[model samples]
Target: MYIGRAVIAGYTNEKKVFLGYILASMSFPKRRARIDEESIKIEPLKTADYNNPYITYNCMKKVEKDKAVVSNGIHTDVIANKLDSGYSGRDAIAISLFAMDYEKDEYNTPRIAACFDNRSLYIGIIEKEKIIIDKVRNDRCMLISTYNKTVPEEISIKRSTAKDIAKELCMLDYEHIICSAVVCRREENDFEFATEEKNRL
Candidate 1:
């Protein structure tokens, strides 16, 4: 199914915290995930239309030693800042999604996000009709998407490494897979990240 941009968070069998972000877009297939030392950003390969504010933004960010935030738009930074400022994962996600509301595009696309630390997991979505922030179990992988799969649901995660987890998420039965990224906590303030783009397959 096509769930648009999505964020997944949970713990691997080894008990390490992991977060994955997938950019599944039919409209912006030319986009790719750019990974750096600090964050992962989704950017268009070429300058097409910058007016669509939702198309380019940081998709994942580590705000603190134990906290990270992932989202489909600019709220990624907003949520991360809130976490950096000492808010709990639940409060940061809820307040950011509530203030940002949904994207103002033609589709009124919902804003989906996940904030996670070593001990807690929170996923949220802000749609035109409603807003949801759910604190989910850290023992199981939970997914939230901008489209059809707007709610958080548990999913199986067989892979443990960052690269394998990212590729596995991109290979899911979802449609229009553009790129995927995974962030895994190795230790306090240490993280391993990897990304997979469809064109590189």
Candidate 2:
């Protein structure tokens, strides 16, 4: 039951599509950052930080102005590149996850991600089987993570600033929480995405 990474999306009263994530890792270190103008990267820090494992390595890449690929491992780059090459969020997520299959790590961790923008939200998971929630409507967010639970795993966050939600996730008892990123489409007409990130440190 290792659901160390997750994505959330839904609409607020302002009519904005919001996407958020919590990267949890009890085994490896994590860092949250915006590496460049478009890409916001979050991953396990290297020996550069401390001894770590490739099994837990991960990253986030911006697929477009509004869309981003947040994943449990290098698969983030794989999916993000496809998006940069002009694939729609759906096709890019499918093609990338289909090719990579699941992580071959000893844990056999599933590969999971989200393709999120102002107008749409998609969640993709790859394990023994694959499931893609192509579009999560405003009524509620469709959330799936690395491990499947017998009970429903989805939870709702009260509409608030990005930092508020991230902090709320940190308050959870789950010992694996590494960091969180919250992206909201505040601009109604076009893509004007604003994000806030906080590392477990």
Candidate 3:
């Protein structure tokens, strides 16, 4: 019932990608969110996932506008810094992931991440020494999680809408899932962002 924490990134338009996260799960988090002029925060409800998750993290760091780094731990910052420093999306993800390797938990939980820049989306998982990274185009979605060692994949969906991915986990009859997905698009000179969430009762 524990999938740790994760993010899913995908293209919603020619110039923007939707980035969404799974709030801490399995247990209802006394979750609180704050959105101000400069930032947005979702208090983490997971104290220990695989290895004192609070120590590492399943956090996201928004790099320069148009790019973001999402990972299952502290590496999120590492990846974001890289992107901010001008590294290509793939390189940022790879370099940061390789630097952290995998969490040294009893289960050897893999670190999952997804990143996107102006027009592309990337997903990856680091497990011990094996790493899988893929560049997913704007029209489809790829799935990954931080649980036991397992391969992640890209799957097709009937509706490639914002409401779609948010329902993924909760629809499984899984009680510990808090999911959200974004649907973004770029109009003539601006970007549009739409999001949706589904939390288990």
lDDT of each: 0.87, 0.60, 0.58
Which one wins on lDDT?
1
What tens digits encode model 2's per-residue C-alpha lDDT throughout 95-133? 988898887767677777777643466667777654554
Model 2, residue pairs in steric clash: 24-178, 25-176
For candidate 1, give the lDDT of residue 179. Answer: 93
Q: What are the per-residue Cα lDDT tens digits for candidate 3 across 1-201?
A: 565565566653342455555654554354432232222244544553342444334355555556665665677778878887888888888898898888886667677888775556888888886898888876765667776424665544433344554455335443455544333334322333333345332
Ranking by TM-score: 1, 2, 3
TM-score of 1: 0.95
The weakest ten consecutive residues by lDDT in model 1 span: 45-54
Model 1 lDDT on a 0 to 1 scale: 0.87
lDDT, candidate 1, residue 170? 82
Worst 10-residue lDDT window for candidate 3 reads 31-40
In the range 11-87, model 1's lDDT, one tens digit per residue, is 89888888899999888778889897779999988755545667889999987677888899999999999998888
Count of clashes, each model: 0, 2, 1
